[model samples]
Target: MIRTFGFPELLFILDGAKWTVLMSLAAFLFGGLLGLLVALARTSKIRPARFLALCYIQLFQGTPLLIQLFIVYFGLPIIGIRVELWLALITGLSLHASGFLAEIWRGSIQAVPEGQTEAARALGLGYISRMRDVVLPQAFRISLPATVGFMVNLVKGTALAALLGLTELTRAGQLMSNITFEPLKVYATVGLVYFAICLPLTLVSSRLERRLNARG
Candidate 1:
């Protein structure tokens, strides 16, 4: 029973964008915090800390997120650990984001000169104080563009949540397309909605990159 592609369907699809945005936000916030820890650990003086962080980053970064999500959501139940859909989605996304962010922040941290760290130490500042006062601020500025670019990728990655039966933007589009039998229209709208959300982010990221380069 095919229906017409109408404004109401379009409106419903638009409404679903809220979930996508929310999911992305949750993933980013939680992931960013965790990633900061990973970055610090990755750069830590302790060999064990670095090794463990490396394993974590490689495990998450090397694997397909779809399989990770499947393991978290489906494979877990086989081992008697029941997982919630949203929880699995957020967890998978968080791990994925954290691994990459850790590397990004780590590189940014390393890019800061050794002399600055030594100078901060000469001022009698401790590790946290040195990073807080001198190192991280600059590293953050250097890393901002890449971080924003990764965020844009994260926004697009939210579509994978549809596989979990979540009626996020992509899932909503799929359902509507089925009912309306208008794959072209529905998908075009979906792409447009994603573009509307991501295009601004892309522009801002580019502008920031240019500004960073200019300042550098």
Candidate 2:
């Protein structure tokens, strides 16, 4: 008798998707904090801080996340530091997001006219005060769209966590496909679920970008 894909299995898939969303949220919140610090360091006048940030961005951006996952999941255990697959995946994705985000924000911060920084300096504002009161607020507004876009990408990237054995959306699809013997259907459902999650974000980012541009 041929087995059919059923509602119970579909519910399981949906349940798995919740974890995917949660993991993405965790990755982004933690990564955004790290990225902000890296962005500041990248823009620092100190040569050592600048070099450290540059190397961090280069290391993560240059390597595929798959390899990084393997290193953390498998290789780290060799050194007696055993992290669960979920932990490893979150750590890897957070690091990857931080590297790219730092660059995006650094560019946005630099795009602010030099005269703006100079004008702040002319007001007797210290470096931290100038950046806090003047520079970063403007820079954050300019970078908001790109940051949203990055967040969307990070959501999709959670599928990669499946390789580390976390039962997220894609991995759940694989299990469903195995049982139902319907790879196309299972993966199509997975893709649709991902689209449902990501589409609104795309629309929101576009609308925000247009509004920002119009104001400019």
Candidate 3:
């Protein structure tokens, strides 16, 4: 039963953007936390922690996100485990983002001058205090632009959530296109919606990068 691509369909598709926003937020918040831990572990003095963190990063970063999403949604059930759509999507995206962010932030941390760490050590600051009070702040500023860039990609990654029955923007567009028999219009709208969401972040990332360079 085909229908027309009209105002109502457009509104419905736009409404689905909310879910995309939610999923992106979920992935970023959780993934950022995980990435922080991973970054710390990667930089840890412990050989085992560094090795395990590296393995985790390689496992996630080396794989395609679509395959990871599939493994979460479909593979878990095969192993006698089941997760709801929201959890599954967040898990996949968060793990993906964590890998990249951990590496990104690790670089940021390393980029901070060794002299600062030595000064912190001279001041009797423990490793935790050194990182929390001295290092992470500088590293965060350095990593900000790259972090935002990754987040822009994560926003786009939410489109993949549609594959697991989530009614995100892309999925909504697909469903509308099916009924409206208007793939071109519906998908064009979807692309426009994505552009609208990502363009600002892209601009913001670039601006921040320029500022960082200016400071340097």
Candidate 4:
């Protein structure tokens, strides 16, 4: 009963790709908001805020993303927090993205010329106004390339969700391979799908980096 790899299989993978895109978007949206707060805390003059933000960034950056997903999906049940698969996967990915994005933004915030901050201060702008109106805008521009690069990584990282039974692209390939007994064909298609998704973002990231460097 070996089914051939055909249009149906391709459609199945595409469906999985759809979920992959959705999951990545959800993670990035939530993570970006949290990362902004963490970045602000990391750059705050308050020592405790900086210390706590540093520890958060280190915890995620220091560990494997797969482990994080496992802890969310499996470990939580032991502590009486039962999360569904979607919740666990998105939560894990969002946390991971936040850690890296926070660092990227923190550096960009600091890289904004000190004099610009001083000028804002001289105008008697409050801390919130200074960051909202001045510092964050420049930092956003400076962070674009790296942020997109990290997004590329995040898309690839979604493959790990397969381990938790999420049926994203990689899991689709696995199921297709198992049924068709055509691991090579199924996996090659998977790789192509990933390349199709990631290459444009890769090119954009490079273009952005070059543009930033030119302006520097």
lDDT of 1 by residue, 146-174 (tens): 89889989999999989889998999999
Best by lDDT: 4
Tens-digit per-residue lDDT, 1-216, candidate 2: 445688987898999899999988988888888998999999999999999999999998899878877887889899999998788888888888899899999999898889999999999999899889989988987898889888988898888888777888999998899889988888899999999999888798888778877876
Candidate 4 lDDT, tens digit per residue, 146-188?
8998998999999999988989999999999999999999999
Measured against the true structure, the TM-scores of the candidates, in listed sequence, are 0.93, 0.92, 0.91, 0.93
Q: Which residue ranges in model 3 land beyond 4 Å of their true spot?
A: 206-216
Q: Give the CA lDDT, 0 to 100, for residue 120 in model 3.
A: 100
What candidate 4 gets wrong by more than 4 Å, as runs, is: 203-216
Pairs in steric clash, model 3: none
lDDT of each: 0.91, 0.88, 0.92, 0.94
Ranking by lDDT: 4, 3, 1, 2
Model 4: pairs clashing at backbone N, Cα or C within 3 Å: none
